[model samples]
Target: MQCSFRQLKEKSLSTEVTQMQWNPKMDLLALANTQGEVWLHRLNWQRVWTLSPPTGTTEGQGVTGLAWRPDGQVLGVGYQNGQVVLCDVEKAEVLHTSTLSHPVSCMTWQEAEDKHRVTSAPVHVDQSSSPVSSQATPQDTAADFLPRLTPLPKGYSATDKANSEEEIVEDNKRLSSQTRLNILVVGDEAGSIYLLAYGLFSMGQLAPEEHPQAKGGRLLSVTLSSDLQCLSAVVQHQASADTSQPEHTICLTTYNTSLLATRSQELATLAMKYGQVATILGYMENTLRSMSEAWEDILLEMDNKLAKFAETIDNKDPDWQVSDEFLQLLMWGKASPELQSFLLNTLTEKGLKKLGLSIDNSYSNIEKLVLNHLQRAGQALLFHLSELKGLSLWYDKYGMLGLNTQAVQEAWSCAGSFMLKTNELLQ
Candidate 1:
């Protein structure tokens, strides 16, 4: 059979294109070039945005692979320099970065079916699981009761980016909640493959050299089947063991990934809960950081006042008990000469009251942030982590997924400790 092909559109670029992938859910195309730069283009070949390699990277370190996240929202660009960067599709801003011990070879991203479209009964989607061990029901979903966090002021709010706000919002609506279970797989030349859950969390790594199939071969590329039942890898083996002039042979290898397909729904819900955990963690961090910055200013003011008082007291307190003198003043409404001079002259009544009020207000703000935001966020985080730990309890099912029950329990306990610490701070 013969088929005729026609090129619809083409564009010339100064750099040679080394790799390209069409977005599965959109008309956008992501291209990596010899210059180690990644570029996005519209359906008509109109240039969208360009992403340069990391600073200080050598010019010879070109892009190795480019994979679009399942929803076509984030693009994963791998480089010969052993770095992988997940970039937002809209403005080419980086979302996350990871490094590999070996240079990257190829990458692929896949997602399980959407969970919201499933007609399961509504479980508390916020906290979907528990280690006490209940099978995932059809209704298992994230039941986030936590308040929606205010979006942080973003760094890339350019005028050109305004046109894609709706698309970006839609992408976030899909990704922020983790409605679909997705994985980003990156293979390196050292016969090692790395996996990222939702393109953000490290899931696990596969060292093919440990397996017989790899017998002294380097990985060339890797792919996951559409149904998530199997993973395929291409390896190049040295047919002749001559170090200076070796003959190479390519081979195909496959691994069973059926659990990924069978447990897709439950894992999707697990990811949803984990997403909740991440969101709450971020909110708590921001709230605590702001409170800390505010307290820093108050600390400086207090330090200034304390410095003067300390200088005055240094000359007077050789053997005197200042605590006893302060207690005597409190009961009798009169202070000794040195103490009276410091209180009435150095610190006037109005000035002392103002200082106390300032400190009180700062403490009040800290209490509000802790009680209203930080503590609650920690609780929400614990709820989600407990659900994740519950998933770990199904050892037969989740064991291969590389989630350690002990690790999950440790994370849960840490969240609890964080909540207690916040309460203690307020007190």
Candidate 2:
């Protein structure tokens, strides 16, 4: 494929660009500058919208990283003050903000593969059970194995349960052909890596998990595999006192995305479940609060106006009759009854039913989310226990190889303790 590039004139931006990212599924590009400004631009170089950081102490911090969610609905901008803000580009509104301990240096967004295909697809081989085969036939490729997971029987062991749960969690992270679970991975100058559950972030909550620290360095870039199982980072380490030049290091990290996804999925699910209730109550609370404040303001204004009117009366003004009527209406709280009646009459049977349907749909979605979360939790727990068993087996093998097993054993013990704690929490 042939590609072309276009240069934007300096007039297009007020300051030099610090970072920029093209939307994965759109012709748009998001740019951030040294002055802490973010702008969206079309591929044709047309300016779209400009966004400034929320006004506060961190407003002066520079923009450090930019990432677009897979669906291209929101842009994630990281700042030098270690704050990440998700913005709805079209609306020019802030969706969510998350803070880190150090300046954000790099970021990457990724989606997992489809779970159904990964779990059900047959294993491909060169030939049907051939030890040495140079070519594979279509029939050989069609050979199948059992699905990645099977339904657990009643009374399964804890290990079996943990193993099954882990698999399910992993499977849940995979993206389907049409759907996506957008994940945001951010790295900072402090050598800390953060994984954000994008769905939760969009919901105004920061669901983040940290990875093992890297060697001291400023992170240059971060990337994730399509499967979401592996992460790679580029770090630029400062030179030591004895050296005249700086050195760069490449750090490759592996993680069970499924486990992280499981945690994030659970959080999103729970938030949705409780958020419905909070939403209804919050709307009512805000409405009443605003109404009360408005009334207070009106009363205060009226008191001052009335005091002035009394002085005008003492000065023998003839306009006091009109002012008296207005004050009487205001004090009676009976202004515009016709408007209230009109609004009440507007609530017809059809309108009422439509409102009911909307509420029901919200509840239905929350129910489904909760059920899915519970089922996945069980599966993930089972998978985790199975993994622990496998680790123990590997530890035995390492012992046979005459490797020092004390550290391994201690690690295993710690893991076991964690599992026990988790189980206790569940119970």
Candidate 3:
């Protein structure tokens, strides 16, 4: 059977259309222009919302790629400066944004799945929101760098999994689930592809086997198969011999969904462990800060005591100027060698007693400061030991999953040894 098409409507835009994508489940069509602007249009060609580029971006550095989340709630826009903004469509707010090292060339969002294959019915959305006319003829082949929509496999739809409102609420809370894990695949101008687990907030580059001809190129587009078993990219490069004409190449990479799932789990675990470590470190920092403040207090107290003692001596012995000089010598060690010896030779028993008491009080303050510092250090060490024990348990649990736990064991042993040394010092 032959398919027929007819013109529906048309709308004009002020800027050139750089990229666009239709929502998988709605009539909304997202469009990007050369001015780094994103516009969402309904099937009736009415504009729903417009998102401008983030502050500090140049007008020439427009959006390079765009993708819609499977739920049609978020739109991911890739810019020339390697920034990806995930915008909430309904609220017209920026939900999340990430920056990469290289300029973003293309991007695609995928729903997470297992290794088993599945199929689903094709989703048909209205084309009136499209910049091109609906009556336009279809192309035999899509542009090399442009992404195309593929129907998702069956048994993977979010609606199918959650039939009730309560179930959907529960599923929404489980953002890390395979069903909720929206993987954002980004290709850059440096010919590198990155896999970002949006739910886990972790990202890593995909390093494919080398192809000599494909060494230096700018990725034009990236698309994943319906099952997500394969990823294909279009790369454009300039040949050394032919500078005037650009060369284009297609690269196909296949991956196991199970491996990706395991990797996402590991990333989440590591992120949690690192967060725990950071909290402990922050506690230690606060303790150290407190100790510093305590030391400063001791210094201030000593200064006040010495000043009071000098004033009392001056008041009590108006005729004896030596008393004030003697106190100054003791407090600041500023007396000349001759004066020091003379004072020592002529010092009275009462004066010596007064100096001794003052020195004793200052020494007591010093001792307290030292003890406080030691106590805080010991507490920090104890907390560290407890954290190490928890890490050891984590290692034991994750070791069965083929992760390396030898480093964790080593750290645990080191903590134990340090605790013993600390105990000896305290004793």
Candidate 4:
């Protein structure tokens, strides 16, 4: 679960790696550096294709943040000039550019759309089984259900006014929307997260107001370390209620490998519209199943990937070799109480199969074979019995193959005769 970023390859890009954005669709990484130079690097182990800057010139622009549009055509670059530039990766051209309020710290797409109005037709619940009062009962109208406030007290103090003002402050609340926009999030050295809704084409033809550079996203101060190394934000996944097209979720990671964020809150909100309680539980269960399966599949794929990587590198490379830590992570941990109960209830069946023995007759046959081997090896079949003679009642408790004294004694007498013959052969 814990992994450190290993440097695969370092290119002496006229400047240090200021910001890097991995293409959403391809293995192309767009890098921007302090020298105001942007380079496109196609990442593959056997071959690396690099597209250098057309002309090396320090335009006094320091690449602070980099982002790739969802469709993979345009790359969003944030610079020290407080400008957000959309660059075409294939043609190596800048498509669109705009300046922001503050020096661009962080930029990302706004995954959630504000839904101020309801569209779908409402379903009326039957009054008989519903928690609300029956229609037959005369009660206060639905207007009463609406949130109402009491009039302010006479001569309210300034402190009370300030407290009421602070209580109404809304923090980073976004409405739900079906339209998908490529989130370009940038975090600056000043520890501010700036999100920009870019790649306007992804949401189909957009009006001038919907343009990426024009419709900038909300700015919030997010949690970051003291050195301001990395910033991460959780985004909303696309809406899926409409059956025409499947929704998409994006995963964003920093160059330092510190933070990872997903855009899926809208999906969670959409699930609650039909029935909040039932939908939320189902969503949680499905999420757990997805996470468990994803980790399992990652380990399964790692087998082949590690093998191929190991073939090229020295076996001693810690990353190439499968570590015991990772192996333990792949193994199943302590079973739940319910699962443990089921296992114990069927212990004989499970244990027998695991040991490669049959439950019904094979186990008994194996036990008999062991006893016979001991008898044939001239081993004494000593029975520690109480001194009370004619203890016929005790024979059944010992499981001596008979309850009656005569049957028990007869079996032992025959076993004794067989032992003598076996001893003679040994002599």
Compare the candidates by TM-score and give the number of the best one: 1
Tens-place lDDT per residue, model 3, 212-262, is: 333587777776554444667777766566465445445544445444544
* Inter-residue clash pairs, candidate 1: 124-143, 125-141, 125-142, 125-143, 126-142, 126-143, 126-144, 129-387, 130-390, 131-390
Per-residue CA lDDT of model 2 for 298-336, tens digit only, reads 444444433433443333656444334444655786534
Please list the C-alpha lDDT of all candidates, in the order they appear: 0.68, 0.51, 0.55, 0.39
Measured on C-alpha atoms, candidate 2 has an lDDT of 0.51
**Error of model 2, residue 221, in angstroms:** 2.3
TM-score head-to-head 3 vs 4, winner: 3
| Candidate 1 Cα errors over 4 Å, as ranges | 1-16, 44-46, 52-62, 91-93, 112-144, 152-180, 201-204, 238-246, 299-365, 399-403
Order of candidate numbers by TM-score, starting with the best: 1, 2, 3, 4
The estimated TM-scores of all candidates read 0.69, 0.50, 0.49, 0.29
Where is the poorest 10-residue window by lDDT in model 1?
A: 151-160
Q: Superposing every Cα of model 1 onto the true structure, what RMSD results?
A: 8.2
lDDT of 4 by residue, 145-210 (tens): 322211121221112343244321110011122223224555443333443334222211112143
Residues 1-427, candidate 1, lDDT per residue (tens digit)? 2457766776788989999999988989888888788888889888899998888866537899889887788899888878888888877777667889888888989775443132222243334563212343345443445443333322211222333333321123235534456788888878887877676666667896556676667878788876678888888888765566558878898988876677665555555555455556656777778688657645655655545555666556576544555557658998778777877788888878876776677666666666655766676677678767777776765655666899999988888887788778877
Rank all candidate structures by their lDDT, best first, as comma-separated numbers.
1, 3, 2, 4
In candidate 2, stretches whose alpha carbon ends up further than 4 angstroms from where it belongs are 1-12, 58-60, 116-179, 199-215, 243-250, 256-258, 261-292, 306-427
